[model samples]
Target: MKILTIQQIIKNIENEVVFEAYAEDESFKIKIDEYIPYVCAAIHDGGQMRDDVLEKCSLSTYERWYEEDPHTAEFVGNFPILIQGCDSRFEYDLNRDPDNAIYEEAWGKNVWETPLSESQKQRSLAKHHAFYEVVEALIQKLESKFKKCVVYDIHSYNWKRWDRPVPVFNIGAELVDHQKFGDYVESWRDGLSLIELGDIHNYTAVNDVFYGRGYLLGFITNKFKDTLVLATEVSKIYCDELTGESFPEVINQIKEGFKTAILNHAFEFIKNETSYKVSKQVNILHNELESDLIKIDKQLYSLVKDFELLSVINPINLEFEKKKFLASNYKYEPQFKYNPLNIDPFEFKRKLSNIKVEKINDISIQNMYVDTINAYFDKVDLLANLGTNKFLYNSLRYFGEPSKKDVDNANFVLYCPEFRMEKEGEFNENEVVELFKNATQDYGFQFDIEVSDHIASKALVINSKKKVVIKKGVKFDKRFTKGLIEHEIGVHMVTTMNALKQPLKIFSIGLPVNTLTQEGLAILSEYYSDSINHDRLRELGLRVLAVNMLTSGKSFNETFLTLMEEYKMAPENAFYLTTRVYRGGGFTKDALYLKGLKTILNYIDQGKKLDNLLIGKTSVEYVDTIDELVDRKMINSPQYFTKIFKKHLEKPEINPILQYIFNGIKD
Candidate 1:
C-alpha cells in the first residue's frame, strides 16, 4: 500500500487553505491516496442559549446570521473535517443529547426570528453532519486496509473565561484512556517537554473544560469502540483574545504541539498492531465460545425435545443471544435423573445458567405424596373413561344427589345442580361451608350439602347420577382454587365434554402421554387468570435451567448443590422442581412453561379465540408432523390453528406488543 508522510498531509492542507476548487495536481492525488484520517468534531458553548444571554436573541438572528457571515463559512469550509463544540449561540446547541432539554433548543427567546427556513437547516446539516460522514468514511477505509485510523479534534477557547479555575494543558477529558493505542500520547508530550520555555504545570491535561455537543464522541465511539479520539482545547492566549488575531511565534509553538501529538499517535497505532490482528483474535474467541456453548445447549435440548414428541412437534426456530437460546413449541425432554456423566466442567463460564439450575434435598418429597396420588387418580380416571362411565359416577356421590340429566350415554351433562349459597351465614347446616365453597369455586363448581349421620366421608359419593364427586371436608387455600380451576375445569372437564361432543370414543379415552400439552394448557390457564405470580414463574424458570443442567452431564446431587447452595433456592422446592423437569429423563418438564407461553401467544397471533383453546385444542405438533397429519386427514382446520401456528416460521416479524403481553400474562 502507498503511504503518505505527515509533511505531505500538512502540505496538502496548506494548499487547500484558499478554499478554492481543487486543481488536478500530483501532490493532491498523492495525499488522498489509500487512507483517510480520523476527525473528532466537537461543538462548544451549547448550554448558554437555553439558559442565558443567547436566549434573548431569536433563532433567525443566531442560525442564519451566523452561517451567512462569509468569514464563518470560509472557516468551516477550510478544514478537512470540523468537530463541533457545544455552541449555544448558533442553535440552542448540538453537543447536548437530543434527549436533553436543549435538543429542541426552544429557549432562543425572540419568537419572531425562531422559525428557520429549509435552506438554513440544509446549510447547518451540510456544515456539521457532512463533516462527520466524510471523516467516518475515510477512517473506515483506512482501518479496513491498514487496521487503524487517527482522529485530531481541534478547538479554540478564551484563556481565562471559565466558571472554574483553568489548567495549563486542557486535553479535553471524558473517558479517554491514552494507553489503549499503545501510549502514543506519551511520546508527543515527551517531545514537547524539550521545546517548552514555560513551567511544567503549564502543560497539564484536564477534561470537561469545553465540553461540546455529544455528537462527535457519540458517533465515533459507536463505530470503533477501541478507536482513539484526542480532542485538544487550545487557549486563545496565543492570539488577541478580543480581536481573534494571531501572535505568529506563540501560534507556531501550539501548532507544533498539536502536530506532534497527531503524528506520534498515528504512527504507533498503525505500526504497533494491524487492525486485522486485533479483530481476528477477538473473532476467534467469540467463535470458540459460541461453538462450545451451542453444543451444551443442544445437549440440554435433547433431554426435553422428546417430551413434545407425544404431541408430534418440534420448534420452528430457536434464537440464541450472548448465551441464552429460546425454542418455541418444544415437545419432549430427556430423562437425566441420577446421571453423573452429562455435566460440563467448563460450563461455569456463563452466568445466565445460574438463573435456571438447582439440586434436590430431603424436603423435595414434601409434596411428592400428594402429587403421586393425583397422578394415580389421573391414570385411574382415564382407565375407567370417567367422562362416560356410570361406575365412576357412583363413586363420587359426595358432591350431592345427581339429577337424571347429569349423566348421558355419551357422557354429556344436560344440567348441573346450583348449590352456592348467597350469604355465608344463610345456610342452616353448620359445617365448614366456607372451606367447601372456596374449594369448589376454583373449579367453577358449586354444590348443595346433604347430611347423614351414618355417612362415611371417605367412601361417600355425592350427586352420583350426575357424575359429580365432592370429597367431604376438603380444606381450602389458594392452591385449591388453582388446582381445581386449572386441572379440573380447565383440562379434565373440558376434555371430557370435547370427547362427548365427538363421534369417536377414542378422543374421550384421554390424550396419549400428552403430558406436555396437558401441562402447557393448565399453565396457560393459570397465566391468563393472573394466578401464576412471579414466584410461580421463577419456579418454572428454575425447572428450565435444571433440565438444561441435568441433561448436560450434571448429577442430581451436583444440580441440587448448585441450585440450593450456590443459587440459594429453598432446598425442598429446588429438589422437587429439578426432579419435575427431568422426570422423563428426570429432566423434561422444564421446557413446558416457556414452550407453553410461546404456544399460547402463537394461538392469539393467529386471531383465534380463547374459547376454542379451552376445548382441549392446542397447536404443539411439529410443522412437518402436522403436515403429515393434515395430509392424512387425521386433523382438520389446516387454515385455522395450524396455519397461524405455522406462521411461527416467520417469527422475526411477530408483533412485539402482542409478544410482550402474552409473555407477561400470568396463569
Candidate 2:
C-alpha cells in the first residue's frame, strides 16, 4: 500500500487505474483492482484515534474498541473495489454527516473530560470529508463505466446488548427504494444465511438490527439513483463483546464464507442490472505468480522422473525371489528392494511454499492453488520415505486406507459365484504394442510404445513423457485390449494432452486426489467399452482387500495367505496383488481403483458430465471451479474427450451383475 493525497487517489479513480493506497493524511485507504460495478466499504472499521483527542477522551482504549467494528474491512478485503477508514469512529464517524460526525457521548457513556476545541473538531471532520470525496469518485467512475453500481457498506454491532437473539447477519434497507432493489436485498440475505461458521448456527435478516439511515448510504443513494447501497452489518459473534479478545479461526471462516457469497451476489446484481458477466481475466499479478509457481512445480516434477512407485518399489530380482518363495513353501516374506530417493523432501517443500497463493486476487483460485501445492508437498514426503517404515505413514496421509465399508464391499465381490471365472488371450507384448500404436493414431498425437522389462504392470501410461510402457513377456487378453485402449489412450492420454493445452501448468501436474478420480475414470472407461469381465472385477476387489490387510498391520505373508486361501485367489495372482500393496513399505493407492470406480459410477448416475474431469488431471472436488474458469474463458474446454463416454451414450446398458456390484458400494 502506498501513501497518496486524496486528490491523487481521485485522479487514479478517474483514469480507471488499478492501485491500492492510503490517503496522504493516513485517514483512509482505497483499492481499485478492476473498477468493477461493486464496491466494499468499512466506514466504521478504523480504531486509530488522534493524540489530541485521546488525551482529552475520558474513555479507555477498550471502551473505544467496544464501540468500533474490528476486522470488518478484512471481511471484504478480497473484493476489486474497497474503501476503509483508518481512524476510529470516535474521532469522527464516516457513517454520519459532518454536523454530528464527532460524538459528544458514545453508547450512553461520557466521551471526554473536557469539551473538544473547535480546531480539533474541524481537523477530524476534514478526514470525514476526504473519505466521502474518494467514495464519490469511485462510485462515479463505476456508474459511468457500467451504467449502475452496488456498494456493500460493511459494519458490525454488539449482539449482547439486545435482550432477544439477533441474527448473524443484518441488512439495513429502510432508506432504499424497495420496489426496485428488494429482490437483490433478499437474494443477498439468502446467500448470507447459507454460510457455515463451524458449530455456529448462521442466520440473516433484513432491517432487524439497524435501519439503512447512515449518511454514506444516503449520500450515494441521493447522488446516484442507479447505484444501490446495502448497509450490511454482522453481529459480534466473531469476537467477545466485553473482553475484546478475538477468535482468529472464526474470523478466518467468516472471511472465506463471505468471499464466495459477496462475489456471487455482486455477479447476480451486475447481470440483472446491466446484463454483463464479470470476465475472469488474469491480471499481471496472477500471471507473475503463476509463472513463479510453474518453475517450482516443474522442479518438483523432475524429482520423481523414474519414480513411478510401481517400478521403484518392486525388487530388481522379483522373478528370482518369487520362485524362491514358492520353493520355501511361502514361509519367508519377500524382501523387496526399492530405488534410493535422489531429492530432499524438506528442500523441495521449502521451494513449493515460496509461491505465495494469498497474492492471487481471487479467493477461490487462491484456495485451489493452495490445495494443489499442499498435495505436491505430501507427494514429495511420500517419495522421500520409500522403503522406510515412515513410508507407510506418509502413504496413509496421501492415499487413505480403506474403511470397513470398503472391506465389506470387497468381501461381497469375493463371495460372488462369478469370482472364479477366467479368460485367455493370444496377444503378446509385441501385439499389444501394435494395438496401442494404432489407438494413438486416431487422436492425431505422437506417443511412444515401448516393451520394457522394467515395468511391473502389463501396460502403464507415463503421462509426463507421452509414452506407454508394456511389461516385457506379458500376455494381453484379446477381450481386454479394446478396453485397455479406452483406459490408457482414451482417458489417461487424452487428459494428458488436454492438460498440456491448458494455460496453467498445474492442471497438467494435477490436483489433490486426482489419482482417485483418474483411476476411477480409467476403470469406468473399461466398463463402458464392454471389456470389463468378472475376472477383472475380482482383481479390483482383491486389490482392495490386500490394501486393507497391509494397512491393518498384516505382514506380506499374512496378506498373501489371506488372498490365496480365504479369498480363493490363484497363488500367482495373490502374490502379484500382495506385492503391489506391500511395495514402497505399504502403498494404499491400489485401494482407490475400486473406490474411484464406485465414485465415478455414482457421479455418472447423477447425470453429471465427464468432459470437465477430462480437461486435465483434476479431482471431482475442483470440477465446479474448473467450470467457473471455463465460463470466464480463463481455461479452454477439453480438446479430446473420452471416446468410450460417447460410445456409452449411444448404448447406455451394462451387465446387470456389474450394476449390482456398483450399487453395493457405499458412499
Candidate 3:
C-alpha cells in the first residue's frame, strides 16, 4: 500500500490505474483492485482522534467507540473498490454535511468541555473536504467507464439501545431516487436478509431505524444521477455492545456471508443496467493470495500422493492367507502385512498443520481455502494412523461412523425382497480392461489401464495419476461393465480432468469429505445409464452394514461369520467384505456410498443443477459458491461431463424401488 496526496490519487483514478493507498494526511484509505461499477465506503468506521481534539472532548474512549462503526470497513473489504475513514467521527463526522460536520453535542450529551479552536476546526474540516474530493473523482471515473455505478455505504448501529426489538440489518434509502431504482433498493434489502451470522437470524428492512439522511449519501446522489447509494447498516450483534469484546467466529461468518450477498447483488445490478449482457472484460479481481493458495495446494497434493491408503493397507499375501484362514476353520484371524510408509505420519501431519491460509481480501474465496486446508489436516492424521489401533479413532474423526439410522436403513435394503436379484458375468479382468480403454476413447480422454494383484476391489481409479487399476483375477458382469465405466471414467475421471484445468490446484486434489459426494455422483451415473440393478443396490447396503459392524467393535472373524451365516453371503464374498472394513485397522469409508447416494438424490429432488457440482471434486454444499465463481469468470465449466447425466438431463428417469428406499431413509 502506498501513501499518496489527494492530487496524485485523483490523477491515478483519471488514468484508470489500479492501486491501494492512504491519503498523505492519513485521514482515510482507498484500494482499487479494479475500477468496477461498484464502490464500498465506510465513513464512520474509525475512532482515531487528534490529541488536541481528545483533550477538549468530555467523552471517554469507550464512549467514542460506542458511537463509531467499528469493523464496518472489514464487512465489505473484499469488494473491488473500497474507501474508509480513519479519523474519529467525534472530531468531524464524515457522514455529516460540512456546515455541521464538527459536533458540539452527540447522542443528547455534551461533546466537549471546551470548544475546539478556530484552527482545530479548520484542520478537521479539511480532511472531510479531501475525502469527498476523492469520492467525486472515483464516481466520475466509474460513470465515464461503465455508464452507471452503485455504492454500498456500510455502517453499524447500537441495537441494544432500542427499547423495542429491531432488525439485524437496516437499509437507510430515504434520500435516494427510489422512483428510478426502487427495485434495486428492495433487491439490496432482500439480499442482506440471506446473511447467516451464527445464532443471529438476519432480519433486514428499509428505513426502519434510520433513513438515508447522511451527507455522504446526499453528496453522491445529488452529484451523480447514474449512481445509486445503498446505506446498509448492521446491528452490533457481532460483538458485546456493552463490553466492546468481539466474537471472532461470528465476525468471520458475517464477513463470509456478506461477501456472497453483496457480490450477487452487484452482479444483478450490472446485469440489469447492461440489459443482461455482461462484458467478458469485467473480470473478477485476483491478488497475491492466489499464489499463496496454490503453494499450499501443491504441498498438500504431494503429501496425499505419498500416503495412498489402499496401496499401504492391502495385504501382499492375500491368496496364501485366505487359504490358511479357511483351513483353520475360520477361528484364526488373517495375519496381514502392509506396504511400508514412505513418510512418517507424525511428520506429515506437522507439515500439513504448518501450511497456513493467509488472510484473503475476498472473504468467500478465503473461507473456501481455509476450509480446504483444515480438511487436509484431518486427512493427513487419518493417513498417518493407517494400520494401527489409532486408525479407527482417526477415521471416525475424518469419516464419521454410520449412525443408527444408517444401520437401520442398510438392514431395510438388505431384507427388501425387491433387491434380492443376482446375475453372473462372463467377462474377465482382461476384458474389463478392454472395455475401459474403449470407454475412455469415447469420452475424449486417455487413462492408463493395468491389471494388478494388490488391490481388493474389482477396479478403482487413481485420479491424480490418470490411471485405472483392475484386480488381476476379478470377473465383471457384462451388464454391469457399462455402469462401471460411467462410474470411473465418466464421473471420477471427468471431474479429475476438469479439476486439473482449474487455476487453483485444491480442486484437483479434492475438497474435504469429497469422497462422499464423488461416490454418490458415480452411483447416480450408474442409475441414469440403466446399468444399476437390485444386486448392486444390495451390495451398497451390505457395505454400509459391514462398516457399522466394524465400528461397533466386531472382530474380523465375527463380522465374517455374521455375513456368511446370518446374511447368507458366500464364504469367499464374506471374507472380502470383512477384509474391506477391517483393513488398515478398521476403515469406515464404505458407509458413505449409501449415505452419499441419498444426499445426491435429495439434492436433485430440490431442482438444483448438476453442472456446477460436476465442475470439479466439489460437494453439493458448495454449488452456490461454484456458480458464483463461474458468473465472475474465475473458473470455467467442466470440459467433460457424464454421458449418463447428459442423457438424464434430456430425459430424466429413476428406478421406483431405488427412490422408495432412499425416500424412506431419515435425514
The per-candidate count of clashes, in order, stands at 70, 0, 0
Worst 10 residues of 1 by lDDT: 357-366
Model 1, residue 617: displacement in angstroms? 99
lDDT of 3 by residue, 1-667 (tens): 6899999999999999989999998899998977778889998988888899899999999998999999888888877789999999999999999989999999998999998999999999999999999999999998888888899999999999999889898999998898888899998888788887767878889999999899999999999998999998889998999999988787788788777677678888876673334543224343334445567667767666444555667778777778888888899888877776777767776776776654455666667766776776776666677778998888888789998888888888777766525575558988899889998899878789999877777778887678899888877887678789899888988898888777766677777788889998998888777776776777888899899888889999999999889887888778877887888888888899888887888888888877877878897666766776777667878878788899888987877776676677636
RMSD after CA superposition, every candidate: 28.4, 4.3, 4.3
With candidate 3 superimposed using the best TM-score fit, by how many Å does residue 365's alpha carbon deviate from the native?
Answer: 3.0
Ordered by lDDT, highest first, the candidates read: 3, 2, 1
Worst 10 residues of 3 by lDDT: 280-289
Error of 1 at 63 (Å): 13
lDDT of each: 0.38, 0.81, 0.82
Off by over 4 Å in 1: 1-114, 117-123, 163-165, 177-201, 208-213, 275-667
Q: lDDT, candidate 1, residue 634?
A: 33
lDDT at residue 232 of model 3 (Cα atoms): 83
The residue pairs in collision within model 3 are: none
